[model samples]
Target: MPVVSNPLRALAGALISVLAVSGCQTLDDAGRVIGRADLVNDLAARLDRSTELTYSADYQLPGGRNASISQSQDPLRAAYTYPGGKLTVTADATTACDTSTRKPTCTVTAPQAANAEPSVAIFADMRKRGLVAPPVVVGLLTAAALDPDATIRQYDTTVAGRHATCVEVDQLSDAETAAFDACITGEGALGSFTGTVDGTELEVALSRYRDAVQSGAFDLPAGAGLIDRRADGQPPA
Candidate 1:
């Protein structure tokens, strides 16, 4: 499949790849050990315990276009709202892709629409069409921490009036000499992430976090014009 060039997904995939190559003992800036495998373990535990989460961030793209993104996550469901479009992927692997503006409403059904895990379905749909989408900053961080080669070191920092641990990924590429920074809260939830791509700097900060999701957030709006991808034999956009 041809690689899709969605800037956000590309950035996420790159960050994840870098973290995958790095080690696990977290440390302070002074080189003193804070905890062994703290970053990895905390992220894992949080994801396992939380039934729902919400993330909101503003993104500055390479061309200087600004975007605001909001995401809601549930056990086997997720919804992304950005600009004029909204996408909801249900636990059954059904994706309702809708745009409030010019685009048409569409539904794409995955092969495992009935039996697969929600996370599995969501991830697969995100990666379909060669797109490397990470549903939220927390999701990306959790995935990176789970990588066998991931080595995350922590430094002290503050974000949004909250004390945080800054986890860094250095040496992403020899030519670029760039580092990725993800600041996480004491409970391992994502606070913010900052990195540069193609000379454009991007930063995402979590403005809100929740432990429960509203059932209606995952439903397609009433009276929406629906285009079934399966019936039309069309590709997902």
Candidate 2:
């Protein structure tokens, strides 16, 4: 008996199996190398020990120029994973796109990430309050000599509903001051900030923060208590 082999059929079957495997992966898996479940668990663990907070109502620009706007308060989730257990936070955030012409634009805030916290316990606190991420927590013990201390100051105190922890950097030397100012003002820094985590040496950027703000992306309220002011006279929230 001669066994006939169907090459066409065999190739077709192989293609179907590959497609099935591809569909199993989540967005994070395709975009980045981290696993979806692992990133989620890691984020949840860090947020556990953290607190809850909210943003100050974003004010309209001076010229009546509006940015995209929407509002959301759902618990946060891990959207992407970075190396060393770092993760990007995702949630349904609000946006306000049109203000002057009254055209009313609408869009959900996309995923925003924070610096990685030192311990996994912070995730626990994030979960208790329906939040997906934790705030930046700077340690006092890390302060160095002569580095002008900077504070994790906050505004819109009522919106946060609590006091944010203040961590000052060591006195800033003349050179350091220049660098810090540049970094804060979006001149030569890495990128936009989202938020900070306690016990971590990460500095977020304005782009990340704006993404979170525009989307109402924050899940945990604990980090909301912190504020950063702009030199352009925009009030901190």
Candidate 3:
């Protein structure tokens, strides 16, 4: 899996701090002290089980730009909607792994410039979609779990009038500094996430979650003027 960038790292760091400050001891269901590794593994497990989820968020980017985000996901597909609906991204996992490198790959289609390179379409689409690649939620969680210096502590909390488990991590070290707090519902869905990256803050909350994805939610809209990198093999028309 590709590593998460500084924004995500910072979000993970803030989550960790929040959980730690909640004053709950690091104890799992088995009554053992939840270490850094254990927490990461636990969160990964929960994320894996969450095959479908939907959420909305407000973000404050590095340049102090405020944006609204709506996202939905299932096991094999993910979609995101930005403010004004001007840019939306949906990526589908066409193959589980590359034949030569055995690395995961996907087919991403999005609106593109007439001069954009075919090879760069997917990456550019990801950047336009707030850098959220396929399986956005799980990808973020997985990246945080892979952090070597991450430490997790969990506590009980209430969010949006619902019971949740607040998991926090501390001392996350990647190529840059970061941390985050995540509130997971009892049903194993992310209720909310709060974090800071390089001093910029981001927060997201789940307004709705379901095991089933809406019809056509993952499909490219009619007349979206999208460019398919794998098919066109040329610049946008």
Clashes of 3: 16
lDDT of 3 at 16: 41
lDDT of 2 by residue, 1-237 (tens): 111121111222333333334334544334321232232222222222221212212212223321111122234232211221112223322111221132322223322222222233433332222221222111111111112233222221111122222223323333322121111111111121222233222333222222243442323222222222223332221
lDDT on C-alpha atoms for all candidate structures: 0.46, 0.24, 0.43
Write one digit per residue (lDDT tens) for candidate 1, span 101-182.
4545757664332222324334343222112233344444544444433345668877655677777765343233245676
Kindly report which residue stretches of model 2 are placed more than 4 angstroms away from their true locations once superposed: 1-101, 108-164, 170-237
What is the alpha-carbon lDDT of model 1 when measured against the actual structure? 0.46
Residue-level error in angstroms, candidate 3, position 1: 22
lDDT of 3 at 47: 45
> Model 3: per-residue lDDT, tens digit, 1-237?
222212222233344443343234433422333353355455545544442345443333334333333445432333444322323432322111111223323333333332332232232332343333223333344445555445666798876556777777677774333577777766555566676543434465655544454565544434344334545453221
Candidate 3 has its poorest 10 consecutive residues by lDDT at 92-101
**Candidate 1 stretches greater than 4 Å from native:** 1-38, 52-76, 96-100, 111-153, 161-163, 173-178, 186-188, 196-201, 210-216, 221-223, 230-237
- Alpha-carbon lDDT of model 3: 0.43
For all predictions, the C-alpha RMSD in Å is: 9.2, 21.1, 12.1
